[model samples]
Target: MKAKVYVTLKPSVLDPQGKAIKHSVELLGFSGISDIRQGKYFEIAIEGPLNVDQAREEAVRMAHDVLSNPIIEDFRVEIEE
Candidate 1:
């Protein structure tokens, strides 16, 4: 089983890296770009005999406990078979 976790900054947070990318894009002639945010992606592979549901539950816990900061970041988890 595999878990894909997407971690991104909260909407209220500022993203300097994303801003730099946006500026670079504008300098390259890209127009009408409003905002950009940077994020993190994690793919965690689980071994053992746990079933899909069990693995999903564990993955959710992992996402909450280890993968994201509740104050500044948001995260989503997807289980891949």
Candidate 2:
């Protein structure tokens, strides 16, 4: 099974990196840009003996425990068999 994870900062949090990118975009002459946000993308491939539901459960657990901090970050999981 394969899992694709997307991790991103919460809307209430400030992202300096995203701000910098937005500034750069403006400097590069991109107009009408109201806001910018940044996020992380992860693709994980798991092997052996697990059903799709089991894999999704395990991936969500990992996202909460290892991949993301539930306080400042949020994550979404996409499962493929």
Candidate 3:
């Protein structure tokens, strides 16, 4: 089984890296770019059974424990059988 986790800042949070990228895009002549956000993608391979609920729990726990700072970020999990 595999899990793909995407960790991103909440909409209320500010992403300086994303802002910088947006600025660069504008400088390069890309018009009407309103916003951008930076995030992390983690692909994990597991040896356990494909229990979606269990995997989601584990993934959320992992996100809280190590993958992200709960104070500033949020995470979503995608599990593959």
Candidate 4:
């Protein structure tokens, strides 16, 4: 089984990288681009003794404890179907 974690900054937090990308797009003559945001994606392969449900649970825990910063980021976990 495998799991994916999508990590993103909370809306209230400032995203400098996203801002820079937006600025670059405008400088390149792109118009009407309103907003941009940057985020991270992680794919984890699960091996060993755990079953599918257990692996999914562990994946969610990893997202909360290790994959994302609780203070300024939010994360969503999805198990492979």
Candidate 5:
């Protein structure tokens, strides 16, 4: 089984990095971008006899506890088998 986790900052939080990227993009001649947000992606390989549900549960727990900061970030998990 494999798990994919996407961690992102909350909407209320300021994203200086994202803003810098957006500025760079505009400087590169890309236009019409209203906003940008920075985030983290993690791919975890589960090596066990766990089923899809179990893997999803484990991934969600790990995402919530270890992969993201609950105070300023949110995360979602996906499982593949």
Candidate 6:
């Protein structure tokens, strides 16, 4: 089984890296861009025989406790078998 975790900053947090990338894109002639946000992606491979729901629960716990900062970030988890 595999778990995909996407960790991103909360809407209220400022994303300097994303802003810089947006600026660079504008400088490169891209237009009509309003905002950008940066995030982290994690792929975890589970070794045991776990069901989709169990894998999701484990992934969600890991995402909340280890992958993301609860105060400034939010995370979504996907399970693949």
Ranking by TM-score: 5, 6, 2, 1, 3, 4
lDDT of 3 by residue, 1-81 (tens): 788999999889989999999999999999988998999999988775648888878887898889998899999989888
lDDT of residue 49 for candidate 5? 88
Each prediction's total of clashing residue pairs, residues at least 3 apart in sequence or on different chains, is: 0, 0, 0, 0, 0, 0
lDDT, candidate 4, at 51? 80
The local distance difference test score of model 5 is 0.94
Ranking by lDDT: 6, 5, 2, 4, 1, 3
TM-score-best of 1 and 2: 2
Winner on lDDT between 3 and 4 is 4
Report lDDT per candidate. 0.90, 0.94, 0.89, 0.92, 0.94, 0.95
Residue-level lDDT of model 2, residues 1-81, one tens digit each, is: 899999999999999999999999999999999989999988999999999999999999999999998899999999998
TM-score of each model, in listed order: 0.87, 0.91, 0.87, 0.84, 0.97, 0.95
Question: Candidate 4 clash total?
Answer: 0
Off by over 4 Å in 2: none
Model 2 weakest 10-residue run by lDDT: 34-43
Q: What are the runs in model 6 whose C-alpha is more than 4 Å off?
A: none
Give the range where candidate 3 is weakest over 10 consecutive residues by summed lDDT: 44-53
1-81 in candidate 4: lDDT tens per residue?
Answer: 789899999999999999999999999999999999999999999878888788889988999999999999999988885
Summarize candidate 1's per-residue lDDT along 1-81 as a digit string, tens digits: 798999999999999999999999999999999987899999999999988889889888888888998889899888898
lDDT of 5 by residue, 1-81 (tens): 789999999999999999999999999999999998999999999997899998999999999989999999999898878
Residues 10-67 of candidate 6 have per-residue lDDT tens digits of 9999999999999999999999999889999999999877889999999999999999
Residue 72 CA displacement from its true place in model 6, Å: 0.3
Better model by lDDT: candidate 3 vs candidate 6: 6
What TM-score quantifies how close candidate 3 is to the native fold? 0.87
